[model samples]
Target: MIVIKTMEEIMKMKQAGEILAACHKEIAKMIKPGISTMEIDKFAEKFMLDHGATPEQKGYHGYPFATCASVNDVICHGFPSKEMILKDGDIVTVDMVVNLNGWLADSAWSYGVGQVAPQTQKLLDVTKESMYKGIEKAVIGNRIGDISNAIQVYAEAEGFSVVRDFIGHGIGSEMHEEPQVPHYGPAGRGTRLKEGMVLTIEPMLNIGKYHAKVDPDGWTARTVDGSLSAQYEHTLAITADGPFLITKQT
Candidate 1:
């Protein structure tokens, strides 16, 4: 069932989002050549703990990391490895969830390690803008497909493909809640959004086809064609006015 959050609950989630957003900001500044993805994960875990929040993704379903650092061809859920050293021109997507007093906020941001290739930079820019397009459709009385179609239209027109394997989801006390939110679909279909409904609109766009392949580790997903991929995500609530971005950076 789709859960409609009360204003009080939304306020609590906003607090959690503040911590998550801040953590992402700090992670962005540290994204540079010579740093390991594991190092980024460790720093994120410490930052959350210091702020009295928990790294909800750690140990989640046997996943043992504070962040999923997907680098280059990896689409999502790339394991943070000490051996994976970042070099110049590498792009990595850091995805994580933060829990503050039981409220959850999730977000993912793709960062350039150094100067990126022109094509790779365009992929990042298009993916981020597609996410915002989707967010714009997250209003009361709109269907989930409206948001999905917006993302798909924008990314495809920009010469990118939307990943079909992993889609967004409702987030609250639990990491995955009701009302699965896809990034590509027919507009005006799927669940009808309502005020107080909170969900994530994450668009994972690829430079090649939308197909993905999972590694033997069963968590890391990468582009099937070994092409670059990018993603941007935000947890938001449908409000009477419009969509309120819970993970909006200060």
Candidate 2:
């Protein structure tokens, strides 16, 4: 069953979302060449705790890290490790979730570590743009597929492939909720979006093939051919006005 957030719950979720957004902003300032993904994870854990929020990803289904640091070729669920260090020309993705006062906020961002190749930069640009395009359709009366279609169309037109294995999802108290959000396909199908319905629109686009494989770690996922991949995400709420980005301190 779909849960429509009440005014009070929405406000609570907004506060949680802001905390989640701030976490991402904090990582952006701290991430650079030579830093290990584990270091980033530690920062995230401390920040969330200091801010009175819990890192939902930590201890989530045995996931030990507070942040899922996905480097180039790793799509998502990349466990932060001391061995994985950021370097020049690499794209790093940080996916984090914060739970505050029983509410949850989830978001992700892709960054170009140090200086990246022009083509790699373009991939990052396109991936981020695709996320925004998908968010444009997160309005009342639009089906979930509308958002999926926007992402798929914009990304494909940019000459990139969309990962079919892992998609975005509804997020709330349980972390993962109803309405699985795919990043590729036609609009006007799938679940009908309604007011107060909140979700994450994460588009994982690959510079090579859309296919991916799960690493032996049983969590980290990378490109099947070990090519570059990028992703961006935002927590969205379908509202009477339009799609409201709850992560915007709303």
Candidate 3:
């Protein structure tokens, strides 16, 4: 069933979102050469705890980490590993979640480890702008597909393919909720968005094919074509006036 959040619930989720975004900023700052992804995960755990919010992904559905550290070809759910070290010119994505006061906020961002190729930076910029474009479409009087369409058009313009295997979802008291939010679809299709509906509209764009294959670990998702991918996410609410990006102070 689709759930509609009350204003109070939205407020609580906004707090959760702020903490989650803060985690993303800190994680972005830590993505340098020589740092282990596991170490980044540890810092995320403590950071959320210090902010009085729980790291929602640590034990979520057996996810096993505070954040998902997807590096390079790993599309998503790339486990943080000490054996894997960040080197110059690597692309890494960090997915974050914080549950505070009975609500969950989720966000993700991809960044360059050091000086990267111009084309790689283009991928990052396009992916991030696509995320915002998707969020801008998350308004009342629209269906979920409107947001999906915006992301698809924007990504395709940049010559990136949107991943089809995994889609975004409703987020509230639980990490994953109802009403799947896809990143590629026709506008005016799917469920109609209404005020108070909160969701995570994440677009995973690949530099090559959109197909993905999961690792044997059953969590890590990687590009089937082995091309670099980028992703960005925001937990948003459909407001009476407009869309509310719940994962930041603004």
Q: Which 10 consecutive positions of candidate 1 have the poorest summed lDDT?
A: 135-144
lDDT at position 218, candidate 3: 94
Q: On residues 169-248, what C-alpha lDDT tens digit does candidate 3 reach at each position?
A: 99889888889999998998999988888999899999999999999999999999899999988888889988888986
TM-score of each: 0.99, 0.97, 0.97
- Residues 1-250 of candidate 2 have per-residue lDDT tens digits of 7778876777788888898888788889877899999998999889899999988888988998898999999999998999998998889999998899889888889999999999899999999999999998988888889999999999999899999999988877878899899999898999999988989999999989999999888998999898999999888888888887878632
lDDT per prediction? Answer: 0.95, 0.89, 0.90
Top-TM-score structure, candidate number: 1
Q: lDDT (0-100) at residue 99 of candidate 1?
A: 96
Clashes of 1: 0
Stretches off by above 4 angstroms in model 2 are: none
Per-model RMSD to reference: 0.6, 1.2, 1.1
Give residue 3's error in model 3 in angstroms: 0.8
Q: After superposing candidate 3 on the true structure, give the runs of residues whose Cα lies further than 4 Å from its correct spot.
A: none
Winner on lDDT (1 vs 3): 1
Query: Which candidate gets the maximum lDDT versus the true structure?
Result: 1
